[model samples]
Target chain A: MKEFELIRKYFSERGPKRKDVVLGVGDDAALTRVPQDKLLVVATDTMVENTHFFPDASPRSIGHRCLAVNLSDFAAMGAEPAWASVAITLPTSDEKWVEEFSNGLFEVAEYFNVQIIGGDTTQGPLTVTVCLKGFVPENKALIRSGAKSGDWIYVTGSLGDSALTVASKLNKINVKAEHLEQAQRKFNYPVARLAAGQVLRHAATSAIDISDGLIQDLSHILNASNVSAEIDVANLPISQAVLDSLDEDSAIEMALIGGEDYELLFTVPEEQKGYLEQNATAMGVPFTCIGQVRGGDSGICLVKSGQKYPLPNLNGYQHFSSEEN
Target chain B: MKEFELIRKYFSERGPKRKDVVLGVGDDAALTRVPQDKLLVVATDTMVENTHFFPDASPRSIGHRCLAVNLSDFAAMGAEPAWASVAITLPTSDEKWVEEFSNGLFEVAEYFNVQIIGGDTTQGPLTVTVCLKGFVPENKALIRSGAKSGDWIYVTGSLGDSALTVASKLNKINVKAEHLEQAQRKFNYPVARLAAGQVLRHAATSAIDISDGLIQDLSHILNASNVSAEIDVANLPISQAVLDSLDEDSAIEMALIGGEDYELLFTVPEEQKGYLEQNATAMGVPFTCIGQVRGGDSGICLVKSGQKYPLPNLNGYQHFSSEEN
Candidate 1:
């Protein structure tokens, strides 16, 4: 009937069992044992209704997206997600909505073996803030600053699909039925490449998960590592949905500026290129070489049809600012 | 600048250097190393505009309260506060508000040596959600279900000040100048009682932080331990602000039903009573014995001058529900 009571009934008591969770929901805090040899990985993300998602967004998809985004962070670091805490606010106490939301949350959590541990439920506009924790071996965590000149840049899975999903959802573009379905699935439940991330731990020189557009997110690695990048536009991984709905130039533009892909963008040194490709493929996640880390202070270029152009000055979908891109 | 750029400038680059933070806030996720012998403690709390704070409330205070509440959860679990991630949503990108918020957050964080690890900044109605991670020794973490009959119930710090602050701020009651200042401090920056929690790990049989009022929160401990408790009204720790503003009956009611004290409510076995008192004092936190646990399937009682009274059919400050208390 009340917030706490409803939470314990639907979330706490029903949460999947995990041996490492020494304590779960209902306590002031959840206690979990971290394996001694690993470092703890933490990331938090918030999804605001009408801002991050449509007002009519399915509770399940919203829930899945909230956790998937956080898992994407772990994926970038080559970490295995272990636990999660959610602080959700709602305008009203609708039991059905709450159930659906938790169902969506638990669905992805269960699939990933991430335990839903502790969080607060409050009254307000609908917002879901999820904080996830995972672990990686000491000194082995992938970092953006490790990119080096001569490293081969790679990304997991195709890009532009999620961006196309948003475009189609807004009716800004016309997509075929199958393309729409494919876009919607990618839009709602873009999988986190956990296994591929783990495999890249030893192979990739540096890594980041693509939440912002490929261009903007890649620039972070360039800025952090003090290196530039040369992306072969033709080599960009274009999703079939986008390929079917848009021209080559528009799809490439979408891949560069469109975000929410939750795919890993990483760099591997020349010597480890073969190792990374083989391992990523064996993990059953697609891997594509898109660019090369170059020896420059700070610049990015797009090479297409034998011409090189400076990277577009478009900013990705930054949540709380202008949307000039 | 975008949300990410603003965050990097104000929150990340400016965050204190903490050794346990293997990698700080620029990566997809922050990496932290938990001590080998301890289990990770996690809790999340969100402060929503209007529901949790006034629209014009001080940003610094809001920031302080967000982390303080999460730290309170750690205190109840006998965990050492360590790292925190904040997911803050804003109606717009106001640089002044962002700076002040980070100031308040870092102020409290620095006091406890806690690290500001990672989080997301987004556009939406103003909301602050904080997720904290602490560490508690394996098998020594306190829980509500550990209480036993005959255990002495104790609470740390004075209570009802925060409630008085809310009442005075809303014009429901009048508090004197000095008392208002005291109440405001308690309202915005209640201490987490971390040291007291650590000491209690060796002495307290069960513990919980007082959040959703004394009566209801204590009932959680009773229900979990399959026991009941009787609180002597005279022993309830009333703050000067509350005493100055309300009559004895109302003050007692506030103490029982006005939550958000962020103080520890704990039970110590008969033999460990002296140990708790001595250690709590040594840790510079006051402790008062308010009641005794009793063997029962489910019940709570109140004692006035010597007579046992049935626990009031009163509800505390439950969000998204009736306000009949």
Candidate 2:
């Protein structure tokens, strides 16, 4: 365990230092101050080897994606990420592995202005858990239960690229050389859509990050809001990389049910639509309207090119399943 | 997959509902409020199977001990624990295992008035990570750096019982039948001296929880305060359970360097010693003055019956060590 000491040194010395952090990293606990008018928001996510990623996955990507996923959750709630606590369990404390992992982790931490306050590093099978804390203005957090029946459903950025990347690696689909890099980048280095979420806090009725695919996550909003939704498969945002790798139905299916896309899925009411469209540039991401919210509790109904689309047999990634998709 | 839903349902429906939690468990992130006059305290601890516990360690004990260790960190800081985010990675979703684990977790949460705000559950090797958030009055935290020369060194409660239990399990010692259950309980359900920590916040110059043993943890205070210490081995507060199971020398060794005791090791200036003694009843634990802080950084100097005592050979528990002691 000298590695333990080294690991602590690596974390304590690196990363952004926030003024609100009265103390950071070295003590039994870190002490911080939250602004008086803001509510603290907390989100946690865990990635496991052979379950969330491949055994040969790059340490950098693992580090980046684990924190990215949690930040995306804060984004969904329109929270400004402030601090993070990471718990990493690995089989060995390989110095090079930890170095690269820290690089990937601190890169995002610095960019998001999130201070790595405290964490634990233990020896075990590879697993990374990040708990993110942020702040949202009082009564300003976007939540699933707030969606109304007449709101227009929208998504930020393109989807399916990350899922397509996973499919390519599993040999379920073959990706072209020109498109492979884009797909891999989309999967490994996801943008959390923080700016868009902040923009949506004023205009959107409800919001959720697309972690468990569009349909599954939209179902969560529908369930919470007691409303139904109709998503137009033809209008689903699919990147060129996804279109080139698979057929139309396959691309649509990937966008609807494949997981790990960190884009925001949100709904805007009729009165807020103009406000959203007028300030589109402020969102920092392209937005597309894919459907509309409907009355009642019928769940999600799919439509494509003016026709009803059949639901796919496969579901979004189920974490506890014996096998990964 | 459905088990994931069931697991989520279990956590969302149980635990103490706290007024400070604006939103918890079901959303992308939990929302909480921190009182204006307090600084937020954050601590994280992870427990991995085979490393932190045996394969057959009860699910209930695992859950309780995992959160207990983190809460102990809060206790050391004299913080009022408020919220927690738990990330649990397991090989399978055994209903009984999860049920018992939740029971144990909720038991501590309810007792401490800490709410389970958010968490993630994933499939992997058995591991549990807990991140706890609390509040402390500004500048009132008992940090390790405040110990001063000539300060009285004190420890709350008895030590070595937890370590003796581990030694017995490893066949290094034989525990008397009368003391076996007490030793196991002390190891499994070690109490965090929250009340004592609060009392010391006003009087003690520095403090730390004894997760890493008396010598190792006391060294932390010495190093941070840039001061040395003389610990009287004869005055160590060892439990009857420890004394009954081991010889005098072995018992002292265990008390000096064994880990997981979770008692408070603190230093009080000469001026505050009277205040501390007068508030001993409010501390809610028996405390012993076992040593005194010295000027300069010569590290810890051990003494027994007024003669210099040799340091023990064993070191405290290191998380990344290959073999458990």
Candidate 3:
């Protein structure tokens, strides 16, 4: 089938229906309405073959993960996911591949009520770059630069499962088949903490989505807000899949440096911690307080027992700079 | 240099200044404020080596062409270009290539006051996908579906220059060195007809950017509005370079179906033709009326010397569909 035909057949009508989309696909561009008093939050992420996923990875996973990562950015900002446009480069004309890819993409998009408003398609190596537009009410958007001294750092959901799957794929770790599969699910389909993000919009002082490793991404908040952090290593959220597979130290390392978790790392005033924890439990989002903001030059340190340890590495998945990913 | 270093060192802090960007680059995303009463107009285009440009094409030209093509979409909609996000894939981390590419991209962007808000860089086959966000006053965006019967069809600038360059490069046409260079300039650095589009916002009934040849793109407007067109081939704005390089017949055919000119193809109500014509000249944008919209089923035909002719193929450089370009 022709590429345009394939696009209309597979991608054009998928995702949640939208009201503010004045014009959708098939036009030269998409026209959408921006509501008054709401600020638009835009984020884009590119996933390339091998660099971001495996060649044999399910096309559905590829589609899901590409859009999923971008949605996580909106989640970090406490924004409502609205619309998206994708530019997909495919090496060959593969009908089934595009079908499954669109299905996967729309599945996640529909889950968040996001509409796929427009896109561009080209022939090349498989790569998907997606840009999402969301909205936050005026003066209510969460930002990384709002953390201050006396704020308590917290993270939603357990970390390291996604990175554990990568280790399993590379044979760097040994685990039971079922356990590895569970971790793989987390790796392939990690959910963005949108509910937690919204709840934290007013409760949290600052926030960032952990695509980079936890400590490394937390440093961004510290730097942006001109504050420091002392994270209690023992308080880190350790998933059962990770704990049952690896020893404490390995699990901790993976939790610290494991990337692609899509979890929300946030800070709240110490006074709000009491209600924030209760509210998170009520909302069914796991919340763990793992650190405290400190008054000082911007930096991050780990607290183990009573001793402060310097960070191992502050960079995560930086292209060409570090080979960690 | 690694990809991240290349992005920060070369592509960062370029382009025209934009004050609406609350957060630009360096983070997981970019945040920009859209004015209260304006609708967001967005378009995305992807350029892949061997598919959209030659592998040996100048990095500068390649950069300029990718963004220029996207801006053409904004021009088609009569929107104000505001910001852009790029997902660039390079075969390797070449500092010089990145430098030249940034120079070309920023040159066009700054001219239109479009800011580089955020982007991703990675190792892969060379591909550039850019998404532009623009603004249009509510209810004022020009669309392809607004042309009515009796509207005069017009196009800005000459056609087939870029395609002529392609023909020259492929040895399909022979031209003097100066003519070939002039054609190459058109091919490499075609300008988006923004000024004309803005002047036509209220004057023109419908509009589209001619990236994929005149006939192929005009068909979009015709199909969208459920109308047909009678374009006079003799009236097409054929450049002297194209005429000198090819026979008159071949030049007309190229103008009919050759792609990637980056000009505006629009329609004006007969009543407003007087205002549109005078305003276009005042805006320093060439306007040529070549046809008229007619009441009929969606289709297009060409006329030369008062004789109706069958339309040539109307498909543009569609991926895996047309081999015209």
Candidate 4:
């Protein structure tokens, strides 16, 4: 099929229909109406073949993962995802692959009420770039720079499962057969904590999504807020699947430095802690208090059983680095 | 260098800064404010190595072209280009290349008053996708579906320059040295008819930017508006450089079917012709009337000296087709 037909059949005809979209796929540009008195939030993310996913990865997972990563960013900011523009570059035009890929993409879009407004499909190595546009009420956005001293830091859901899956795939670790399925599911279909972010926006002082592991993403909040944090190593939320697959130390390391965790990491001031506790059920995920924000320069201190825990040698994922996936 | 550092050095610290941007670059997502009573217009375009440009093409031109294509879409919509989110995938972090590439990107951004609000830098084969967001007054956007029968078809500036350059490079045509330099310049730097689009908004019933040749893009307008068109082959605004190098037949062919023109093709109704003519100088480029819209099923006819002009066998570019760049 031609590029125009492929796009029309796969993308333009498939995604969630939105009322605010004045014009959608078949135009020079997509025209949308921003709700009155709402601030517009924008996020862009790219997933490349080899670096971000295996060449043999499922098309559905690839499509889901690309949009999920960008949604994760919006979740951190307490924004409501409204529309997306996807640009996909592929080596070949496989009809089945495009069908399954659009299915996965539209599944997520429908669930999140996001409209696939416009997109561009081209010929090249496999790469997917999603640019998401959303909205937030004025002064209600959760920013990385808003954490305050004495705030209790919390993370949504368990960690290390996705990282453990990746480690196992790389042969750096081994997983038991019983836990492999759950771990693979965690890695392939990360659920963005959008509901939790919206709930946290009312109480959390600041928030960030865990894409580059706990430590690295937390460091962004710390650096932006000019504060430090002390995380209790024993209190880390390591999933049962991850714990069953590796030793305690290895699991902790993966939880700390292993990337692709699409969970939310947030901080709550002392006054809002009770409010968060009361409304925690509305967050739509299991919550855990892992640490406390400290005054002073940016850094993270790990505490294990009353003593300072030594930092591990593992590094968070970074694109263009020698150790990239 | 790390992905974050590279992005900070090349993209975050550069580009035009606008007052509407509440947050930019560093955070997981960007926050921006939309002016009251304005609607948001979005356009996305991607350029990949080998498919869109040669591997040895200058990074500067690649950067400029990637953003310019998107800007051209906004120009066609008669929208004011404001913010852009760029997603770039690269094989390696060549600092010099990045510096020059950002230079070209920022050069266009600054000239057009567009803010580089956020971006993603990933590792892969070179690909750049730009999603641009701008604003158009409510109900003021020039849409392809608005054309009416008897509307005069017009195009901004000259055509066939870029395609002629590509043809010469592919050894499909020969050009004199005098014309070669001018053709290369036209191919490298396409000036999106932004001012013309905005000026034509009041006068034009419909508009589209010619990317995949004049015929293919005009067909889009015809299909959308449920109209047909009749082009006067002798009246096409072919550039002197193109005519100087090729025979009249070949030059007309190039003008009709050559892609990557980036010029605006629009329709002005009989009632608006006086308005368009009065405001022509303010459009920032010369325009020529070459055809007229007709009431019928979608199709295009060509005429020369009141006789039918034969349609050529040449096809416009399409991804995944056998005849691709």
Q: What is the lDDT of residue A122 in candidate 3?
A: 79
Instruction: List each candidate's DockQ score.
Output: 0.52, 0.54, 0.48, 0.55
For B1-325, candidate 3 gives per-residue lDDT tens digits of 5555567677666667678988787766677889877889888888888888877799999889888998989888888899998788777778899899988898899888998888777677888888899899888888889999999999888888888888877888888898878778988998888887788888988999887678778877998899998899999998778988888788888888878888889999978988886785654567788999999975787889999866665454553522111
lDDT of 4 by residue, A154-239 (tens): 99899988888778888977788778888889788888899998998899889999888888889889999999999998999998
Chain A TM-score vs. truth, each candidate: 0.95, 0.96, 0.95, 0.96
Q: Candidate 2: lDDT of A65?
A: 91
lDDT of 1 at A178: 89
Candidate 4 lDDT, B51-151, residue by residue in tens: 88888888888888888888889889999999999888888888888888888898889899999988788778999889999999999998899999999
Flag clash pairs in model 1: none
* Residue-level lDDT for B157 in candidate 3: 82
Ranking by DockQ: 4, 2, 1, 3
Residue B187 in model 4: lDDT: 74
Worst 10 residues of 4 chain A by lDDT: A316-325
Supply candidate 1's per-residue lDDT for B192.
89
Candidate 1 residue spans exceeding 4 A from truth: A313-317, A321-325, B321-325
Candidate 1 lDDT, tens digit per residue, A211-289? 8789878988899899998899989988989998998788888888888898899999999977875675665688889
Model 4 global lDDT (CA atoms, 0 to 1):
0.87
User: What would the DockQ be for model 1?
Assistant: 0.52
The TM-score obtained by chain A of candidate 3 when compared with the true chain A: 0.95
lDDT of 3 at B107: 88
Restricted to chain B, the TM-score per model reads 0.95, 0.96, 0.95, 0.96
Please give the fraction of native interface contacts (Cα pairs under 8 Å between A and B) kept by each candidate: 0.64, 0.66, 0.50, 0.65
